[model samples]
Target: MKGQIMDKKIIVLLSGCILAVFLLAGCGNDEVSSEYNIEYLNKDKTKIVDVPYEPEASDTDGMIKEFLAKLSSDSDNVEYRKPIPNGVEVTDYSLDGVMLSIHFDADYSSMTEVEEVLCRAAVVLTMTQIPGVDCVSFYVADAPLTDIRGNIVGSMNQDSFIENPGEQINSIQCTTLKLYFANETGDGLVEETRSDVYYSSNVSMEKLIMEQLLEGPQTEGAKSAIPAGTKLINVSVVDGVCYVSLDENFKNQDYQVNEAVVIYSIVDSLTELSTISKVQISVNGDTSGTYRDNFKLSDMYDRNLDYVVSLEETGVTEEE
Candidate 1:
């Protein structure tokens, strides 16, 4: 009986130990699999762009906090620069429906107009990329944001930043075109200005932008997003959407950049034209499909400036 009692006690202890191990394993597996692609401003501060990062926390709030930490200017990644001014920090954040409210310390009130707009743009672009989050609202110590128009913005979406037209000059000899190209790593897009691109009465600004993009980047560290020999078949604008049709060679090219890089490179470059708000791509007249099965081309894509990589994120300071 004594030996039987000892054996029973051993079995009970082993059972408890097994249960504890299983519980620990379950906890270890709880981390979320989703990665957040956060946006930051480029080196010249002309464009905002994104870089991918995996948040360490499993909960929504924790994931956002982890993202804010990366955006705090203390992160190790060279490509994760923060638009939020130095000494500014996200005190807290919350989500309701499609809106996210971020509360900052009092220091946030000190940012200049451009600084505040860019900072808010970065946060909204970064957070909205996450599933189920569409809009963002800013707060400082529970006070809401008031626009220059005197109306409090309930929330701001991507549409809040519309492309305002710059001064346009029409001359008989030549015209300038603005184009966006992929960075060397193919992780971001860089804006390149083609000031003296020769164009006649037959050449449209839309055509010139695509032609310049296909010609590839002039800057050393920038790269061409379009594949070689990809000819632009036609471009037209109906309503607010720009229809871009390319040749069959556009589909089977050997460009190694991310699909987002390739798609946005074209979409973003053309959308720089204030006349276009969205773009639809077609390969060999087939608008019902996608490019390389990566993304559906049938759907119209707005200029995803968020996919452009920030030059600030690409450089490491000497102190690091």
Candidate 2:
């Protein structure tokens, strides 16, 4: 009878150990699962919505494939829409170092400008969340993606699409810009203080400055120094120097504005950003020729306040 009792107790102990092992395995599974934010466009396609998702795949490559599939698939929530439209298909993808390049079929090029931008933002924001992926680049029909303005849309990260606090993505933010425009006589620069300028968070400060300069000045005595019809190809900063590339239209100079005035308008406005201390202007990425008669496109210009005439001197009041 004692021997029988010992066998029963041993069985009970073994059962308890088995139960504890199962409990620990369950906890391990829970620990392996990770939550990631998947970006999608709203129904109206005006804003990007962040949806929390727990991917089944834990490995980097597996997560990327899962996320891409999810992006193209329908969202469980009614309010959100898939960023990759139905007709467009991701043909192929490759990962190199930290950069992920996704190639799309020709249908991708058919998307509207707004659709394209929102899609690009969504993909970049979502994919960068995966480990081993730091940036994303898009390709269509074997060609690198280009913006509406014909500039190559280079690798993009989270910072490429600015998000406002409390507002998820592509929200408006106010900023103040100190811009330089040509004086009425077109011989010197006039300072223009534009405050409360509302713009999309997606736009970088450097790009905004260039767009505003292209829009011309609101002040009475100030006029745009950049040639009309000129298109911005690209604008970026590196090592304290801002590189600005424009289309061939940039060579169409307004002879009335002094070459120096046109050059300084760009140089001083960009130098306003602490990150950029010098400005380099390029035409189609070629830096070899003179701008017109004097300024060389290859030269990196510094801030020249000497060319900047006071608003008072231009007979323009601050209120104007």
Per-residue alpha-carbon lDDT of candidate 2 for residues 1-320, written as tens digits (9 for 90 to 100): 12221121100001111111110111123444334667777666655665667889988899889999999987877777899999999999999999999999999999966577668877887898887888999999999998654669889876665443333324444578999999988988988889866555557789999988988898888899999998889999899999999999999978999999999999999999999999999998999989988888989999999988887887877673
Off by over 4 Å in 1: 1-173, 315-320
The regions of model 2 sitting more than 4 angstroms off are 1-34, 163-199, 202-209, 212-320
> Would you list the clashing residue pairs of candidate 2?
none
True-structure RMSD, every candidate: 22.1, 16.0
Q: What TM-score does each of the candidates earn?
A: 0.44, 0.52
Clashes by residue pair, model 1: 78-313, 79-313, 188-309
Model 1 compared with the native: what TM-score? 0.44
- The CA lDDT of each predicted structure is 0.65, 0.78
Worst 10 residues of 2 by lDDT: 9-18
**Residue 52's C-alpha lDDT in candidate 2?**
63
- Tens digit of lDDT per residue, candidate 1, span 112-177? 555666677667656665555677898887888775434475787654442221212111234556
lDDT for model 1, please.
0.65
